[model samples]
Target: MKQKQMKGVCLLIAGILFLLLFFSFSGIEKTKLLDTDGRNFEKAEVTNVISGNLSNSGSGKQTVELKLLSGDHKGKIIQATSSQSYLFGAKCKKGMKVIAIINESKGELLASVYSVNRGPMVWLMAAVFVAIVVAVGGRKGISSILSLVFTMLCIFFIFLPMIYKGISPILAAVLVVAFTTVVTMCMVDGITKKSVAAMLGTIIGVVFSGAFALIFGQVTSITGYNVSDIENLVYVGEMTDIKIGELLFAGILIASLGAVMDVGMSIASTLNELKEQNPQMMLKELFQSGMNVGRDMMGTMTNTLILAFTGGSINTLVFIFAYNYEYQQVINMYSVGIEIMQGLSSSLGVIMAVPVTSWIAAFLYSKNQK
Candidate 1:
């Protein structure tokens, strides 16, 4: 079979297996009404719409009489209210769906109306994303989406749980990165020699980024809890054996993985393509091609990493500027300062990954092509 044919078959089988695993282990359970944990109150069914009218502010408020939909007190009618807050203006209307959390002892219900139901939207968006990906990239696109799904599952199911269970954050993070790299590469590039090169490159880049984060963290005497989120994690760690500093380092490394992967894959793929195009190319010429592509990618990839951080922290930057802190002090402050360090460190990882991966691929291609 042709290489493309084999890759296509492998991708299809992998996708089917992924879907099977997803549904088989979805952890769905039917719960009894009164016996369920965190069961605050039963879902209330609206029985009578007593008053549906606009108030002085032209906002619609509805007084709904509701009864318990399930459980022991299923037949009792009680008053429930749904109103659009004035800040939302007159857009609120009657019969708009809302949730009512009831108190059995007090026979009272608190209602909050949402503009949209997230449950349906989440599933809908996921389906749409998958459809669009498959439509655009075909087999490659499917692989990319599967890799992304697996990555998310590993983070949520494996990494987050391990961290919550008090495992060392850095250790958990390393495991997550390793797992994600394998899964992502396999799906994106298939189980080929090229994919293997990409995987190796990813490992090297990831380790480099992680080490830099650790070394910089120590040299700067920056506490793990310096950042607002990590500071909260410190309190969480106090309740468990999880070390905040290690976890913080793990986060820094993991955060750099995406960009590192980008650089690694770009170099590896470019080298492979060059080899295929000119089977007689020497190691020097191949390495030159890889470096040329890397040079182009390095600037944009690093900019991508930095801009992402900047966009996320723009609000914090604005707040600091508003406070009138001196420029030196503002930049030196730990709030946005750590992000700056992190961004630059990750950028260095991307810059370094290109050459290292390219060199490895250059040597490998020269040996293998002949």
Candidate 2:
């Protein structure tokens, strides 16, 4: 009971620290080009939306009365004119939330309706997810949620900031992965030998996966510029000293980290349980048991990675198939090749994680017995 209380206290302290760090990093200015002279964006609630006749462009004009929810003009009621295009514009309605841009440069407090405010909806969905996880998973669910929040914090705060500050993208990703793995494993399994073994295995598997992705990407001529919005990223890279070229394998390493950690944790946990059940179980027997468990996990985990990547790029595949492209042509396409690389590299990580985890678990558990 005392141990549990201490663990809870530690988690509470960590959560507070994480929140402070999140807000501090989130507020840091990221853009070097934007020079706004007293211009700000604010959230507003639409009290009334008056519609005008449709224009020749098949769009309507609206006079929206908004109550400011944020910014220096909070609680101020203002009227804003908005043109709503039939095909693309967001039509505001009564009581609907919207984002407003405030321009003070003209010495007039003018609020322009930008778009519908979707932030609340996103937060609502996240709340539902957390409630369900906590309800079903109980204490373990809480641990999982904490780990998830910490992982996101690491990505958003540590990884992104480091990359933006001119650190190597690959090195930043590696550090984030290592940090996430250690925190996640410790949260789930406490400070046990199983957690240590799992952490080691996860780190090894993720590193190998990154190495494979880098080597194969070079061999196949699949540069990181194959994805959408890469040109814009290249432009940003010019402004910032970011090496956009190394982002591909860095992406692969981060994407595969979850599956690798899963495999490692599973193998280590199974070995620990087996050792606890039969204290006299030989090291060889424990190792074989872990292998058996890992083999079963490997098949499904590999398929999961492949299907996940395929699902994300299903539209690209459909387009290629619709064009009746030859297999050679389709495989040679940069987009398709990159997807294949991601799937295969991630699967390799999951596959390698099994044995790496099993061996470590076996050795550690055996030593614990002695």
- Candidate 1, residues 1-370, lDDT tens digits: the string is 7776766786676557546645543553422223433334444555566777876765687676666555655666667666656543122333433345554435444443323223557899999999999999998898788788778887776676666556777777777787678668877876766777777887778788777877777777776778777756665677665577676677777888889988888788888888889889988888888889989998899999999888879988888778887888876678666787788878888888887888888888888654
Best by lDDT: 2
* Candidate 2 residue 62 C-alpha distance from true site, Å: 4.1
| Candidate 1 residue 68 C-alpha distance from true site, Å | 7.7
Please list all clashing residue pairs in model 1, or write none if there are none: none
Q: Estimate TM-scores for all models.
A: 0.77, 0.87
TM-score of 2: 0.87
Name the candidate that leads on TM-score: 2
Model 2 collision count: 0
